[model samples]
Target: MTTSRSFVLICTVGIFCFISYNMVRMPALSLFAESLGAGPERIGLIVSVSTLTGVLLKLPSGALSDIYGRRFLLRIGVVAFGLPPFLYPFITSLDALTALRFLHGLATAIFAPSALATVAELYRERRGAALGTYTACTQSGSLLGPFLGGYLIHAAGFSTAFVTAGVFGCVAMVLFYSLHLDVSVPQRKEQGTAAVLSEMWKGFSVVAKNTKVLITSVTDAAKMIANGALMAFLPLYGVSAGLNPGEVGLLFTVQACTSFFSKPIMGRVSDRMGRQPLILLGLSICAGTFVCIPHVSMFPVLLLLSAGFGFGEAVVSSSSSALVADSSEFKTLGAGMGMQGTIMDIGHASGPLLAGLLIASLSYPMAFGVIAGVQLLAAGVFWVTMKRM
Candidate 1:
């Protein structure tokens, strides 16, 4: 393989490690905080604050990658990403935890945009397959994390699980450092603030005006909301229904296994069959499956729903990313992906909190129902917009 391809694979493996590191701690943060004498409100603040920071910063990071070189910005992500997990054990107060979470969000803001920007640069000609492979790597990392955590927490406790994530991240950083790329963020000879703003505005303008991207972003955002709930709430949901930790872990496995294969298949199909139809079908399936989720409580039902959810997300995630990369220039592709991440993060940030609230007041079914409805609407939007494109 070429250097860039090898680099992409290395970065992907690091991402896998990163998710494996964080998966257990993130989903179980509320429980971990509870052990530390925090309640839902505190956990909410910690989680939301971090999420909010990441959501808002994607745009600037993308712009920076465009202007400053993907290498510099990616290094920012590596340091930010690799170092944060070490500090978790040092957090003695809720405020400290919340502050760390916010800082941690910067890792995603920097890394995802820059890393994805690398793929966009190397695979510009075949992003559907390339990003499919890329996202699948992340899903694989996410897949491994919870299972590792569930087992590890019993053996080592929460702090071990949390601190270990940082250590694993160092492994990823080392690999990321070794990989080389051909693209540098376009450099300028000392431009004015107005010039920078104009450039940023132009990126936003393309995001707003492009039909393929608008549809792709909106639809994928909706799909992420559904997934956000599943990843965020499945453990509670499993326990509430009287399932064991093993069972809960299995659900994650099912989702991951299907999604692992879903991307590569979807990518080849999109290349052969076309992007829009596949995107539309994926969203419809995803929405329908989420609607079926709340009603399921048995082992068979859980397995089916997990696979369904995985299939839906896998299809949409790869397709939408490729579409976004397709829609923009190399100069702003990272920013474009960042904008995509930002939009998706909005749905992700909202999905969990809303599900928690709904589960408290209404029913789990209601939460899933609402998410499904949003996705259905999004599917429509995708079709209409893609038709125009």
Candidate 2:
């Protein structure tokens, strides 16, 4: 029940929960949609529907956490993560798949902000490092999930992969329910529905008006735009380039591995050096690496690009979340984190749709180059905005 113990438990739960979530996400989801006869545009829709759920719900969920409690919302989130993978095996059409993905999106929309606020509260003195480590734990899921999912799909087929993902999710649910989290919930004398709604709205108003939080979040969203694009198209691109599904999965694993290793180190550095420089540097690195992805067909070269992009991601993420925490009021911490999530999801959802349109009309190289350009432009705007502030 100590803070350290609670942090560890949360991180552990995050690992299993994300592993469950990602196994269904990567190469598997796109490939499954393809089997259902989807084109690039429809595939993009299926992939982005989940993120759209986050755009609509993350801020409200975060605000509600401030009024209700982190644990209460977290329980719902784990259940969301746990139960949905079981239905993937039954999905027969693109419409069913897209609907299921949106329903599944509720897991992260509800869980992420509360979990982040809890970590920020737990280690107020070294939020960068603490948040980095926690996020790295979740990144471990990203590292392993694709590899397992890809292997399952290649060896056994989609049903086995989905069922296995469900098992991991169930494990997370059980662990979360069994452990007693020691984090304190805010005490409110008014338990009326109207009072709760008013409190939630106040949290929203405060977060919306915070310029620093908004800027930091928008910067993070720029990076997520590229991440989302890669998640949607990289597998198909890799396969087209002569890599198998397993190899495609490894590409993602390598990218995630680089991020997993770098986040804590970069986070500690950010804690001492300040966040703005790292954010700008990370964006530049992301732009440089991302624009090069489509110019190469070699597996080794693609892996290198993936790793570089991942490091850039680590650098940005390690600083951005901590920066948002630093800029928020303690009372509305959940709402601040939620606001960031909402903006990031908006960018995330747009990435696939935009990339799909571009790739369909132009080429892969052009699509990636344009998205990378967006990152650089965002960095320039972020730099000027931060300097003036």
Candidate 3:
């Protein structure tokens, strides 16, 4: 492969690893914290706090990518993402775990938007196709992580699993730097901090003011909220419904693989069909699927239910990022990606926390049922604004 191709491939794979490192530990963390005497609310706090940091940091990280260059900024994120995994195995207290998680969140903040910017930069004209292939790596990682975690935990222990994650993260970091991605190096050929900040704010301001940006960003935010619930509550829901860990793991695998495989196709279809119809369809399916989950107790029935969320999400995620990139000007791409990250993080930040609260006060069915409503509401917003567009 050419150097450029190699660079893109490697960096994309590294992004996969970063996501994997963040997620694979999730089930384990829940178990660990519970064993350490943390309650459901505390576990929610631990997860939410980490997301809160990512929410806070995405914009700055994007602006930093804009000013510093994608390559250099990503390098920093890789290190940040990697270091926390190492610490995971050693931490004892929930408070310490929260602190480590917060640090780990910084890595996500750094790696994702910058890496996205790099992907957007690579195939500027084919935004959907480009992002689909790139983002699919993340989905694939999401698929592998839990599967890997499930087996590892059953076999060795959570400590071993944590250390394994750290090792993979370190490898991903090394591979990332070695690939020498062509993304810009953050440094001033001729610009001061004030100018850079001004440009960053300008990007944010522009996106906020644009109607398309607002609607699409909101659409994405809603999908992320559902995603957040899926990640945080799905396993619990499965367990509550009497799924063994193996069945639960199988559900994750199917959803993730379906989502992963479907991305490029959805991206292409969205390009041809226009974003609105696909958005509406995807959201409707998601909402319908959520309602199904509460009803299905059989393993096969639940697996099909899980597929609905996955398929809907694949369409939304691939198309939404493409839309965000499409709506933004080229010069402000970094800021645009940052804006996308920031908006989605709002829902992402709230999903698990809100779901946990609902589960605590109400029930898992009620919590996820409300999420379905949110999905429908997001679809409505898209339909109204999209018609105007």
Please, what are the lDDT tens digits per residue for candidate 2 over residues 1-389? 99999999999999999999999998899889988999888888888899999999999999988888899999999999999999999999888899899999999999999999889989999999999999999998899999999999999999999999999999999999999987888789998989999999999999999999999999999999999899999988998999998999988899999999999999999999999999999999999999999999999999999999999999999999999999999989999999999999999998888888888999999999999999999999999999999
Which of 1 and 2 is the better model by lDDT?
A: 2
CA lDDT of each prediction against the hidden true structure? 0.73, 0.93, 0.75
Each model's TM-score, in the order given?
A: 0.90, 0.99, 0.93
Which residues of candidate 3, in runs, are more than 4 Å off?
1-7, 10-12, 22-25, 184-191
Candidate 1 lDDT by residue in tens digits, 1-389: 58466556645745645564455444455556556776434544555555677688987788777777777887777777677777777777877877777888787777777777777787667778877887787777667766666555656676777766767677777766776655644758769888877877877776666666656777788887777677656766776787755567677777877998889789877777777777788888888888887787897798898888889888788777887887877667877888888888777777766666666678888878988889989888777766665
Quote the lDDT for 152 in model 2: 96
lDDT of 3 by residue, 200-281 (tens): 7877787677677668878888888877777666666677788755566667777777888888899888888877788788
Clash pairs of candidate 3?
68-186, 69-186
Give the clash total for candidate 2. 0
Please identify which of the two predictions, 1 or 2, would achieve the higher TM-score against the true structure: 2
Query: Where's the lowest-lDDT run of ten residues in candidate 2?
Result: 182-191
Candidate 2 residue pairs that clash: none
Better of 2 and 3 by lDDT: 2
The prediction achieving the highest TM-score against the true structure is 2
Model 2 residue 190 CA deviation in Å: 0.5
Work out candidate 3's RMSD over C-alphas. Answer: 2.1
